[model samples]
Target: MAKGAAKGPTVASLKKVTPENLASLGVERLAELLVSVAETRPDLKRRLRMELAANQGPEHLAAEIDKRLGSLQTSRGHVVWRQKPAFVRDLDALRRLIAERLTELDPAAALDRLWLFLQTAQPVARRFRDRDRDGAVAAAYVRAAADLGRLLADQDPHLAANALIDAVAADPEPWAVWAPETLRESSAAMAAVALKAARGRLGGAAPSLAVVRALAQAAGDLDALRGSWSLQALANPSVAAALAPQFLAAGRVGEAGEILRAAAPQPTGPSGRLPPPDFAWESAWIDYLDQAGETAAAQDVRWASFERTLDVDRARSFTTRLADFDDVEAEGRAFAYAAAHTDFERGLGFLMAWPALAEAARMIAARPDDLDIDPAQAELWAAQLRRRFPAAAHRLLRAAAAAAFRRREFKLCDRLTEEADTIIL
Candidate 1:
């Protein structure tokens, strides 16, 4: 069965949606139907029409959920959940609001409110049905039946982010009997999250590809593992430096070089007493880098950034997030070493890995075709790898150039031929 689908026979069928008893849908299509009902909930929708007929505040309903939930403050403060009140008070208000509205409004709005309220009142939702199979909610599972169909139809990256994967992987109930696409979509979601995580590490965001892939695979949604808004939002020049090594490990040498070049200072003197990267920015960067396979470099940055965030005297577990690199049993621990106990010499050594770091000004200007294993990128990585081993960039450059020339377009051939002197063998 698809991820996120509810298990067992249909609790009840909708008016027009039942096709030989909607149970025939494989996990994927069943999930689509489930998500569809979640968005509109026909029974609830008809009820909502009655409320609109009687003139309930569409605008009032639309009002930002402030007074009920209270103020929210964070980096991404505008995300709607900001208005959520404290657990007890929020649940009380939700019950009161639903009761008052039920007297006049239709079922859909009331249900929508109930859904949103359920999301907010997690405890109540859990009590009602704690299907925390994969760290997701039951509403999400039901919503999946309604949401997946539309999501598949839209095929947009934004809406179908984490919930679908959670539904399939986390389902405690036997929803497999009802939906197959739920599992299929969950697979897609895993891949999506993986791509996103890869993009983040390579692009100077957080190193979460491993996490997404690990979690999504367990949930049966490899394709869905492609995006992470939190990680993407944190990217910048400073963050890139911290993200460099992970990018290299993940087959994104160009992105890694780009971040390091921007963040690390130009070397001075033999040992290199470089200017410190901004502590605030470097702290987060170090956290991500530590997870990206450059442990020595990560430790080095950790020392510098920790000095910035903590007092000179305090000492505890130097950690940020508890990351899972591979599988749970064969994985790195969650305690991604925080900057608090990081050492400076290790950080410095990591910086030394990149010798001629000035080459990354190219990726930002690169287009899709220019994206094949680039020669310019090869040279930069070659400089670093050959330093520790006998690695060379010449062969990689030749292969990329050859591949570029193989394309039907004459323009690409001309371009590679033109830049050969500056970048390749």
Candidate 2:
């Protein structure tokens, strides 16, 4: 055996304990051993119960599940983060039990059970109050519901669509409303499956506008999909954006554009001041423009969006589009515009990504002395500069080291000092 290896029963030794041996251990001893095992591995107990339930009919298994679910203390009120493990395990176990039971029922029957599980599970999952974990639990139930929806769709799409529509249209309880994004995504996936099935059944006939509206309504909010559109739908750009692709795919390009445009940030809201522009909606609109064969309009949108946000990736994308156009003059003009108007950090990134190293160095040198820059970012720029602009690299590193020392960041100061010395050498 290797050093520090644990000594315990080997596989061969454990294999000696057969069912016969277990049976021979009198009921009391066996029960004690089972309790000990269950105490050590709670999952084993759940599995054991599920295994026992497997032999019974679906009704028995469901009853067992309900009993377990009922026993869970979901109303413990403001669970400490430290106690999340027990709650997570309980919910996960219930989810597994529900999934296992789902496998035994026919599609329609399974859908009913899944719907019930979702209705019950939503409030229970929300009890955690932690957004991330709550979302995760909600996502798990959504996945379960989606899986059932797919199964039903495979058997009978119309039936699946109806069931899914009804589930989504059902008003959410107060607690269930907290995790709307998860619910929306899961419901949307099911709706997509339903729509695909319905389309296939229709066999090339355009789905009636009513059918489209019904599917969209299943996503819980239908203002964007209603026959009459609403500006308030823009408040949830994701919802509006989600509907746009469906419209675009259906060749309703004008309607899609309307949806996106309405969702764009207006100068004023009912309360007076409009909220910030939703980048998601803006990006979606740019995509729509490109798809509509309005290349110049798309480019304008991209540049305008980038200017408004200074989003680095957006800037890079605009520059890439210019490069693709083979317009070197345009690219240079864009770079000059960015350097003059954009923040130094964003401009530096844009120029570096453009591999306009010379321009980047000039920009770094020209930045005002009192302007704050992240030390880590400065180090990165310094390293990049070292390859082509040694003097600039050395200056950046010295400044970074001095700043680190002033901030009492001795380790970073030492590292920067060493790097500066290497540049000098």
Please give, for residues 1-425, the per-residue lDDT of candidate 2 as tens digits. Answer: 99999998677865587886578678999888887898877666876776577577666666666666555434545556776666566666666566555455534444555556666664565556675445555656656554554445445445655565444435323213322332233445555555554433422212333344444455433442544234564446785677777677767788778788777776675787866667877777887898789988988878787776666667666767775556576567667766775476777777777677887777767775733557888788888889789877777788888889999999999998898899853
Model 1 lDDT-worst window of ten:
331-340
Candidate 1 at 164: error in angstroms? 19
Candidate of highest TM-score: 2
lDDT of each: 0.40, 0.63
User: Cα lDDT of model 1 overall?
Assistant: 0.40
- Superposed Cα deviation of residue 287, candidate 2 (Å): 3.8
Candidate 1, 1-425: lDDT as tens digits: 89998886545644346666566667799777666774755333433343454464644543333223232111222212322223233344334444355424434444344334433423334332223433333434344333333333333443434433333334313333213333344444444553444333333222233344344443443223323223443244444543454455566555554455555555578987775566544544554555556665765555444444432211122332224533232111211222112442222222223221222222212222333454455445545544333212333344456776776556665554454434332
